[model samples]
Target: MAHLEPLDPKVDSIRILTLLPRVDNPNSKELFCKLENRTLASKPKYEALSHAWGPGQATDTIFINGQKVVIRPRLHDALRSLQTGKGRSLWIDALCINMEDTKERNDHVNMMSYIYSRATKVLAYLGPSHSAFNKADMKEMGESYHYFSERNCQLISKSIYWTRRWTIQELIQAKEIRFHLGKGYFTLDNRFNSLSNASNGSWLDDHLERIENHRNNMHSHLQQLEVLLEMFKDLECEDTRDKIFSLLGVADDTAQELIEADYDVDYYQLYASLIDYHQSASPLQCRSDLFRSSTYDPEPWRENWQGFDVSIERSVRVIAFSNLVQKTLNSAVNQTPIPESLSLGDPIIARGVIIGSVMSIGETYDDYVSSWESNKKWKALLESTYKKDKDLAKWRENDAAFYQEMLKWDHSEVAAIQSCDTTKSYGYRESQDDEHITREALDSVTEGAQPRRFLGTKGLMGFLPPGAKEGDQICSFWEACFGVVVRKLSEDRWMIVGRATVSKESLTPAVTESVYHDALNYGTENTSYSSLLSRTGDEFWAKQKDLAYEALIFFKLDIPTLQKLTA
Candidate 1:
């Protein structure tokens, strides 16, 4: 290791290994590589070897430039298999980059995309020996076997090399890639030419398929780095810092600008900075995570995180109705240097208008789905859904349109929905075929099924987050939507439960201002959604307006205070 030489960074030069011809004892598992610098301008004719180090074990000795070097046995086997009698030149990250030099590691790791893309060819080593996983094993079942055996599927899924984070960008940016799966190999040109068909990306690992598809469809709203971050957050990596570091090479140019690669920062700051970026630049929508993903992840890190189920997409989105967080989150971009003292577990403080307290929550998700899925007709489903609820459902049939449109509780205006009298607005929507409900309207009702129905104080009826409770405050947080469920943990301390949707609202413009006072209680201590809406008069408004003004002064001009968002 002491014989390692540094490359001149002026021309972006890097080291490549030339595998020496086998010795007289060809059967020996010996490897000797000539490591030397190759500049990009000189057009080095060498293939880059991409492989996982695999838990950093299995000691194997190899000679480099007449000096002995230790590497993983898999890598040693790759050199032996890939080498020829003449010689084979390749750029292997483990040997080429001087790990002893921190600055050199930073420089090379930062531009991994360029290194892999510029290579003559990229050889991805998945196994160590000639008996390593190969598609040729499938030939015994049949050349045209449609379904892959459970063993082959298990082998592919369980392969550490396939799931490693670095492997993603290496395969993506490569100009050409050849597989080194022991005796079996395949490329885009050929899926070992043994399978029936491998035209689409199905031939690759599931992780690669998911990421590559997202990359292809990235021109749409899914272009943000958050998508990739959320998608591959759980991938395997030796170093925790690599969770974020590994994605930078393949992220969009604009997304890449949000954060810089600095090996000095701990994983906490790195993850916190990603949180800062996701809050500010991500698409306008509200996310409710299955776990506390917005706050922490289950990755086995230095920090003992409560891990996830590792199977589900924790972050789910629904249409947003307010612009509460826009101006407040903009300041996130200006603060580039994430403070080292930033605590990941610290709860962020947010100031907003307390709209209402949740009064009641409907049946559990499983029950509701069981009932709704079985009932085909829209009218029958609505009738059966509210049979137990005495409040909204009692008068719902009399004014079905008002109930369905959620305009019944909007005491401010009954004319909010133009067609209140049209029967089409009830169980059915207006369309060319008025006899049957539009499929979109029927499906949209439970598409992002919050499952539990809830009525808020002040007669606001809507769905609550999965984690939300009956008494949690549904706040209209500045730069956020209407149904953000927050609970008071202590005086002036609140934790976000999740985002909910307005009863029947869609993606409308977020209101710039609200008359909702911070301290006003819309519902009383024991009574639910009733009694609160009845107390009405100009005198009440007159008093409430004075209180609203007082609340504004208390909150300091309604400009939201930003805090670390924790669940």
Candidate 2:
């Protein structure tokens, strides 16, 4: 064993751990290691090792610079597998970086993108071969296999190594990638040949194809950021900040200056800065396709768009707002009604169904800004006034009764009342006969009151209901647009928390049925709301009769406007 020294940060160089060939004794406790120093400026040739660090408690002793050092058991296995007769020089992050030194770790991480890109080759250690693999069976099968079984493919695809956040950048930046599965080693270019005699060839091939697809998609720097965010959303890191910092170097050139690796800054602050940077740098293109549906017309705002200026403190608010607006517009334009067969329930009256056309589309930043400001002011007033005056609640209850009375009158009578210009106060008018009051007259008498936007429904702006998510669909009827219900919310109620986007392209009956069934399956198996519904007992079921029947009603309702839009 050789004694290793601290890496010099001043020099743009890295230390590589060279694992010597195994000795004669198979059960030998001792292992040899030699430290090789290389600098990027000199363009040194080395292979980088990428592997997942398993449980910290399961450690193995390895010789580094003539000193015994503890490393993860998996790393030890990787080193043993890579060792050759002539020995091998490898840059493994765990061994190469001084884990005890925070500054050194940061410096080394900063150069990781460059280090991997410049490496002669990258060896991905996927630990032992899966037990399902048999070497001889694959040799006979040859290239005749059309597809690998999904279960077999998942063995490699779902491995912990692939789940790591850091390995993504490492694997992507490498000049060349080779996989080490147990004692077997193979490059992607010749992976088929290496797998010719293995039973798990198809599985390995599928995994390789996925990796190749990821690599190809990451060719664009901006696209890489998008991929990174999606691919690593569930991936874990000890320091949450590293979640963003680790990908900075591999991200677009624009991102380099936008965010800097700082241990002092909180992860949320880093995330906010990243969102702000992305919004400013790529305003029109959102990172997730969930927010960028085909029906959204960015072209209308393209010329006058001033771009989103998301603040670090308000990043979540901005993102939520943007998502809501974009999703509503998308769902409204691409409405899809349920099939007729799904509807078996009797028609039930739906109150407050506002119906209207989109009178004019706002196509500028100023339009959005003005609308947002006005809404904020109105919200503030409502909150402040309601908090101060308890009488407002009583007034609203009385107004609701008056509105119900107006609803009972004939259309001509209602029209006459709507056209009236009476200025009598609501309180004063309420003192008189109920038949004498008009809707317009009631409106004029109320202090600080404005006519409801949906009162007549001549010009209405569609919006998502509270708690709507990406996959929820919106259905348009002759009179109004409605959210489709996947499951029953109550015995007499169904949930349509948000509008779902329907694809414009037409599907075959079978495919359409399959999609609908899948949605139902998801609702039943995955949703928390579905779980609550299940526990509602016999009373809930008796009232609902068949909840699915009610769900079908919402899905099957005919919407001419939506049909034409899809058509």
Candidate 3:
């Protein structure tokens, strides 16, 4: 067994494998490689591999510098598949970094963004079932990804490479990226325009759509931490905290990570650094105890405060301006510069009052995602509850017009709710020729419901995030379309469970307005933001009205144990 050679502590210095060419002799068929130290400043040309080393033991052996080095089968296969040209080099994590050295591995992990961006090319190795790209996989330059068969598309979605947390950063950071699979290799230069399938169905379809969404986000440069977190929530790494850390490199917030992260990627300085980065998007900022001064505007964010993510402040979800923040901004007053409030991990002062509390909870997002039958159960529960509730006429008397308008639309006839389970049914229809399940809008309250639903303390219907409790207070941020759940931590300390909805009615497919549209919705600002007064609900933004912002806003901030925010 050969131990990995450790490099000196030069910050920019890195390890690379200068793989020796094939040995033609029949006696030794084993793949062999020799290690060498290279610095990025020297302009080393190498193919950086973005791969997953599965949980399996390192049972497969490859000779390194005439010494045996055991690696997981996945890496061994990846190495065997490589055709290292003479004098060409490779930087694959499994072999290049000294995993046994905690300090070395930590340093390299922090340098991942720099390494991938500097690479001549990046190969996202799918698995051992490797195949070389040919004319069949490459059309002209790279139009082949646009023409993959519906079946092949399914197979691409099923690839295990998509499940790794680290791959997300690799995908975003790669100078030029290619996907390798068993049947072939291809690179997507543009959005996936599948020539065959129009129906977005099955888990496979969800995976494909997610890829498209990933492309769209990158295409549009929507790399905010909240957006990336929501986009890649399902992705996993060995340490759950790395789920957040792995993404920091690609997030718009972390343009310059000046501080060294903890080995776990969560330390006091690093946490404060992230908090600083999150606030980088805020036009409403204080003088930097870190980073440059800003002419950064909150204008673009204003339009889509709820549509996109505002940063997370401590345990509280900071989506919109607190009413007080708006009032301060509106009144043009000084905040006395509570700079330490956030960076030191103090609770952000939320200025809004409690709108409601959890009264009754309903189906989980996973519940609806489990099956069509499960969503139908969600529908049945809501309809029986919302439609028949006589108390709505009393408690929500001011919202009479909304209830009446909803009843007129429901017509007391079509008893079933439309499937708004976007993950499962996004862009799906019964037939392409005819609209049988006539593809409902993805933003439709039915298509992208919250992870859960709950009856509010006021008998209003709204969203229920994962940890909502019976007495959790649904509080408001300034400009968001939805309200968040704040469970009392103590006398004044509160924990934001997540964004919850509190509307006039339950998850009904019946309403035209988003506030009352059974599912929690956002980005629907009209001439008037959704007020305490329920309007007709018809004034949705014209084009992308049905596009759901399906980001899970609650992430356990992987910071050093800090004090919870105080009210």
TM-score of each: 0.54, 0.50, 0.55
Q: Report lDDT (CA) for all predictions.
A: 0.50, 0.46, 0.50
Model 1 error, position 388 (Å)? 8.6
Report how far residue 217 has shifted in candidate 1, in Å. 6.1
lDDT of 2 by residue, 60-96 (tens): 8888767787777888878877776677878888877
Which stretches of model 1 miss by more than 4 angstroms? 56-58, 129-154, 192-205, 211-223, 279-564
- Clash pairs of candidate 2? 1-66, 2-65, 2-66, 3-65, 338-555, 472-499, 472-500, 473-500, 474-500
lDDT, candidate 1, at 310: 14
How does candidate 2 fare on TM-score?
A: 0.50
Question: What does candidate 1 score on TM?
Answer: 0.54
Model 2 stretches with alpha carbons more than 4 Å out: 1-4, 27-29, 140-152, 189-210, 217-227, 253-255, 284-567
lDDT of 3 at 28: 49
Best by TM-score: 3
Clash-forming residue pairs, model 1? 298-307, 323-479, 324-478, 324-479, 324-480, 325-478, 325-479, 325-480, 348-563, 348-564
Q: What does candidate 3's lDDT look like per residue over 1-567, in tens digits?
A: 244666767547887887676657634447778788777677888889998888779898877788888888887767655644454588888788876677777778777877888888888877644243232543334322445554545555666777888987776677777776532356654224553343555564565465555545563445666556655667777754466568766765555653343464332333345444544544222212111235423453344344432232211324332222222122112212323443444322223345556766666544544567865765565555556666645544533433344334331111111121211111111111211222222222433444465556445555455545577766543334455555654442445444554454432222112221211233232321224124334443332244221111222222211111111
